[model samples]
Target: MKQDTPTPLQEADDSGFAVRVTQSAKSVAAKVLPVSSGATALLFGVVMFLVTFGMVMVFAASSVDSVRSEQNILSVVFRQGLFTFFGIPLMLIAARVKEGFYRRVAVWGVLLGIALQCLVFTPLGDEYGGNRNWIRFGDFVSIQPSEFVKLALAVWIGFVLSRKGGRVREFIPAWIPVAPVAILAIGLVMLGRDFGTVVIMVALVFGAMFIAGVKIRHLLAPLIVVSVVAVPIVLSSPSRVRRIQHFFDGCTEAEYYAGCWQQLHGTWAMSGGGVLGVGLGNSRAKWNWLPEADSDYIFAIIAEELGMIGAITVLLLYAVMTYAFIRIIREAQSPFTKIVTGAVMVWIVGQAFVNIAVVLGLLPVLGVPLPLVSAGGSQTLATLLAIGVVLALARSDRQSSQDGEAPEDVRLAVRAEGRA
Candidate 1:
């Protein structure tokens, strides 16, 4: 066959395809590249590593349970992976959103979060482990709305406090809409009886407020009120009371088979791992001896299988993440970015601390998952989305700095607003 030269139309078509491909490649590269600050890149990398490690751990920790429950061995990990698949893109999309967009939606986000949480009181509500905090779509799908509530509360607090400027130092101006709305969001979760989440939310609010420059004296009043309120709530539930007593007084012999089962097993798992762990996928605790082996107590599984080295490595990763958040907060031009980043830091890192502490028997069994390392879809997706918001803030600050506007100029503007 003779190879004929292309006609003008064919040549035009080929050129068009080549240009399209080039443009497409550039677009993809733009999305993939870390063209922002070092903090953004570091945060992204740390998150990805945690997520991947979590998936592996979830697989290892959940396999025996899956087999015992007569489900496919891959079922838990596959579900976790599926959420990660969706979450990573959601995170990227969130990172690309403008700060103005978050400000515009902050109030509405809080409202929507509250609405979703309220669904747990309706027929759609589902209960697990004594807390009614989930909305079930059917047998196959259920979501914990409190996870999204934490994000909304963080954004709302940042928006309100940032706008308040120097007024944040005053009581009425600082707490007015922010404190009330936050209380409502947290109270709804409290109604669900998930005190663990409530505790984290409290930390998030205080962290944001402190970062935004609220007076320490003002915080003390609320601190006392929260302490007073928490006591009654803790005493209201017999199970809660028992867990608290077990934490302070230590577990008795009869209680070991009852209320202290999870804690005792968790301690054993941690001790069994020694320094280097038994090796991945070799945890004896996951064989039904430990409750929530893949979620709340996943760190114990890490200890049992990966040992002290693996466990410490995970802690170091979180420490690195904390540093990234601090970098972003320090470099951000806007008060909102700093406040929001601080709130998210407290939420994720504080929750991780709480989870790890519970596993180590320093705290009671709180039923909180290990952030990105747990086998829970809602917790993972919500956490990734929060990180995306922080990334967006970091990139915005980076762009502002690169545009030749000095940090002093931004500070002067804020000071001018405060004077006004």
Candidate 2:
């Protein structure tokens, strides 16, 4: 017997009306967003805002130092501005890149990164504050290979993991390829004695693993290994030891004259601004009272110049950016794109919090620049490029949807049994 065919029309009632309204709204969304196309725009806005705000803050924070070093106040800001100019275009170009292009370069990029890191131990290496993480090309140009390596390693990990399918849950085929490479990549960074960057890289790896469906129990081994290796490195330098020992000193007047100098001053600069801030360009700490005013502790200046309100605003911008990243991760069709985008989000957002924690004295001072806000050309360029990859992923979803097809995403389905 043939069952009665269900009619498309619903009987008139409150629930039926709700269903109609929902369907109508969905149809409208399909015509407009088409799989949340707004994510790319949101990503673009947040990146632009952060970069612009960073440029302004860099000018404000560095003007004092620039004048003391060079006759012109705009000297440092101009240099940074030039880089920002270049980075913005690079970011836009990245947004136009295809996912397959990223995949093709993933392995080579990491190999190049590893080769670059080796330069830091060569004749061209430069050391500042105790970490030898930079290489110089004459007096005019310097680069931190670790920054680029961080991005490269993340991309390579994502590429490998995405190809693993259900084997990602297994110890040998999935993790052997990823874990050893990560360790080697991080091991190179460790040779520079830059533990801060290593921490961020670790978070990047962990985030990629989670997105690839690795189990929590499998992560413990790497964490334990990294911690064992990190402790000795942290103690190898007395400056790092002192920074760790007196990190919670609260910058007492006595301590301020000693190891707590930067943290103490950062605290005062932040607290002095209170709710509204001391007003932009009017910070007392910018007058050589605070070290690294424009680099690692730039957040202190943001709080001092713009106030708690301004600091919170910067955090809100980051929060919005992370939201867009989440949307891309959820919607992107390709596993490689999904993995890479998720890793980028983890690195950027996690690094931001770790940086802020240092400023607030909740954690020991580690020389980590605030993402786009800090003064470092190599760091800025590398980070902006990574963000560009995210924008590309954000667009990938819409592009796929407009084609009116579903992605096989067989890797996800193949791994479901492992997830169980």
Candidate 3:
């Protein structure tokens, strides 16, 4: 016996609604993001290339110091190689991690890092180069908690802003808890008298806040207030006050030697490079003429060795990397990815510029490392790990591509931005 056919209206009144809803949900789930493996490959290649170049330059710049200290030409190079060996693989592992996993782990990661920073007060922390920020497990291994603090602060700010939503700007003292935490962190470093790391952390906080949509008025208020308050901090330190004096006075008098020595030599090194540079690994500055040749003054060494063309090329590469990162943050599907990548980009490039500016005598020295190019293991690893997170975001982005339609939530959010 044949059953009677159901009418369109009957079906609509029955299972049509449920069926359509199920199909739509499935469709939305299918189109999570547009992941691009090719972009990931490109990013990895570029990062590795830059890192390798830095390793080579580290050897070139540190050779003289190494020979004088240890009589081993490979001393600094081997140490840098060790950092690369460990850091590169960790970066790769971080790149494969999922977004949700990162979010979940951020709080714990930051908390652990903060705990480590507190250890600076203990006997484990070693004072070096006038900064007591270094924590030594042994003579062979040491970690700079400030390096990890950068990531911690970025993650913490991203989390706080993400949770607070639009009310992040309001003065509820909801951010009050973070104040003590930040003070403790900054205070500990300041106790060590490591102004460079403090500057970096300051930049990282401001960068994260800006990208996470903190109001410009809100940001500028504290910044101005801080500047006003900081006048005493700068004046209180004899070394810092003297450096500032020399910066304005110009490096003319021989008596300014102690204060202006690094800047003066750095400028001479850069000037000596002229156009085509002396040659890679042929820097006269690295021959003990410039202090911190492989660290703060590496750029001057590059200018001396590679000349204007090389210096400009390195600058342009950094510019390209910055542009790429900005593109990644802008195109990111989630606020978490956007804020994280933006913070890291600012930290790396901003620090690089600060280091360069100090060497060029355009700014007072803060002793920040030149990101991937610097000789510090902690900084090299931290920077690479941060970039790797960006690569993971890029990977996840390319994976969610499906049909032409995206989720209603994504579509709605994009529209909201326009309206806002």
The model with the greatest lDDT is 1
What does the lDDT read for residue 335 in candidate 2? 74
Flag the better candidate by lDDT, 2 or 3: 2
| Model 3 / residue 263 / CA error / Å | 1.2
* C-alpha TM-scores of all predictions: 0.90, 0.87, 0.85
Candidate 1 lDDT over residue span 1-420, tens digit each: 999999999999999999999999978866875337778888889999999999999999999998878668998999899999999999998999877789889999999999999999999999998999999997889999999999999998888788767878989988998878888999999999999999999999999999999999999999999999899899999999989889998866678887889999999999999999999999999998999999999999999998999999999999999999999898887888899999999999999999999999898988899999999999999999999999887777777778966433245547768788
Of the candidates shown, which would achieve the greatest TM-score relative to the real structure? 1
Q: Candidate 1: how many backbone clashes?
A: 1
Per-prediction backbone clash count: 1, 1, 11
Task: Tell me the tens digit of each residue's lDDT in model 3 across 182-244.
Answer: 667776777788888888777777787788777788778777876786688778889888888
lDDT of 1 at 322: 97
Ranking by TM-score: 1, 2, 3
TM-score of 2: 0.87
Q: Tell me how candidate 1 scores on lDDT.
A: 0.90
Lowest lDDT sum, 10 consecutive residues, model 3, at 29-38
Instruction: Report how far off residue 358 is in candidate 1 (Å).
Output: 0.3
